[model samples]
Target: MEEFFNELFDYNFFCNKQLIEACSDLKEVPKESMRLFSHILNAHQIWNARINGLESEFGAWDEHPLKTWEEIHYENQRNTFEIITNTDDYETRIDYQNIEGRLFTNTIQDMLFHIINHSTHHRAQILADFRANGLEPVSLDYVFYKR
Candidate 1:
């Protein structure tokens, strides 16, 4: 599971960089796309922090604007790599509080999988925004990354 997540994180970072580079020259993109991408990263960070028993830096969704794209992507790469390298025991479980302050325990493996799946879902929306803005979207399918 750890190896699988490591590969997925690497693939995700590669694809994210490609998408950013592909749209580098675009004068404008839908603000919502940028917002959503940042939201994904922030959510991941918040969840990670919670699982690690650290205080979350981000408040409720209404409390902060999604971070800038460059910032989010940079931190995403950093955090994903940290997660891959620092986590060795897939069975290690952590207690976490949800948005509603409900507490539960989950394995590190499950949390890592959730982060990747969450990002994939939102990246599709970002791609749609690329097309809507007349920009060519990068191929971000997992199969494309695998091949």
Candidate 2:
């Protein structure tokens, strides 16, 4: 199970890095794309903090500068790797409060999967933004990354 998640995170990291690199080259990234990517990065950090039982430093909808995206992303992925390595039980229920302070619980594995799935969903939106802006969209399909 750990190996499975490790591979997934590796793929996640690759896909995100590819998109960031592409966005970095553009003169002006679309506002919608920036918002979506920021949300993606912030959400990943938030989930990692939840798993670690710490307060999140980032809000879900904060607008982070594009210049700082890669650094923030690396830190998030590193923290997630640490969490995965240290976690002994994938099924252990984690009790956490959302940004709205609503209490909830989920297994470690489920939350980890959510991070990747959520990112993929938003990255698709970002790709659409790229097309709308007359920019080439990055290929971020999991199969593309796999091959």
Candidate 3:
């Protein structure tokens, strides 16, 4: 499972870089798509920090909305790398609070999977947004990465 997650994370990071390269200009992307992408990246960082017992650099959504595509991409790559390098016991439980202040516990493996899945969901929306804006979206499927 760890190996699978690492591969997925690697593909995701590569695809994200491709998307950014495909975009002619960030200003052309829909605001909503940008916002959603930012949110997903921010959430990933916050959760990762919590799971690793590190202080969160940003507060909840209210405290910090991701401001730039560069910021999102940088953090996304950093976190993905961290996850791949992490070899701690996958079964170890991480306790963290959700945005609603609800306490929850999950294994490191689950958290990593969640991050990958979450990015996939939002990246789909971003592709749709690109098409709606009359822009061609990058091929970001796992198969595309494999090929």
Candidate 4:
């Protein structure tokens, strides 16, 4: 299971790097693209914080400046790898509060997978926004990363 999760983290990092690079190339990134990617990075940080029993350094919708994105992203991925390597109980339930301050509990494994699924969902939306803006979308599909 750890092996599976390590692969997912690797894939997420790879795809995120690709998307960020493409976004950086734009003379002006679309507002929605910026918002979505910011949300993606913020959410990843929040999840890792939740698992580690710490306060999130970012909010769900916070807009991190594009200039600081890759650096922030690297920190998030590094923390995620640390979490992945150190976690001993994936099935243990984690208690956390949502951005709305609603309390809930979910298994660590569920949260791990949710992070990947959540990022992929938003990344798709960002791609759609890029296409709508007449920009080329970077290929981020998992199979493409596997090769």
RMSD of each: 2.8, 0.7, 2.8, 0.7
Return the TM-score for each candidate structure. Answer: 0.80, 0.98, 0.82, 0.98
Q: Report the C-alpha lDDT of model 4 over 25-109, residue by residue, as the tens digit.
A: 8899999999999999999999999999999999899999999999989999999899889989999899999999999999999
Q: For candidate 2, lDDT tens digit of each residue in 89-122? A: 9999999999999999999999999999999999
Best by lDDT: 2
Error of 1 at 53 (Å): 1.9
After the best TM-score superposition of candidate 2, give how far the Cα of residue 49 lies from its true spot, in angstroms. Answer: 0.3
Residue 109 displacement (Å), model 4: 0.4
Model with the higher lDDT, candidate 2 or 3: 2
Put the candidates in lDDT order, highest first: 2, 4, 1, 3
What lDDT is obtained when candidate 2 is compared to the true structure? Answer: 0.95
Q: Which ten residues in a row have the lowest lDDT in candidate 3?
A: 60-69
In angstroms, give how far residue 91 of model 2 lies from its true place: 0.3
Where in model 3 is the C-alpha error above 4 Å? 24-27, 59-68
- Checking candidate 4 for backbone clashes, the offending pairs are none
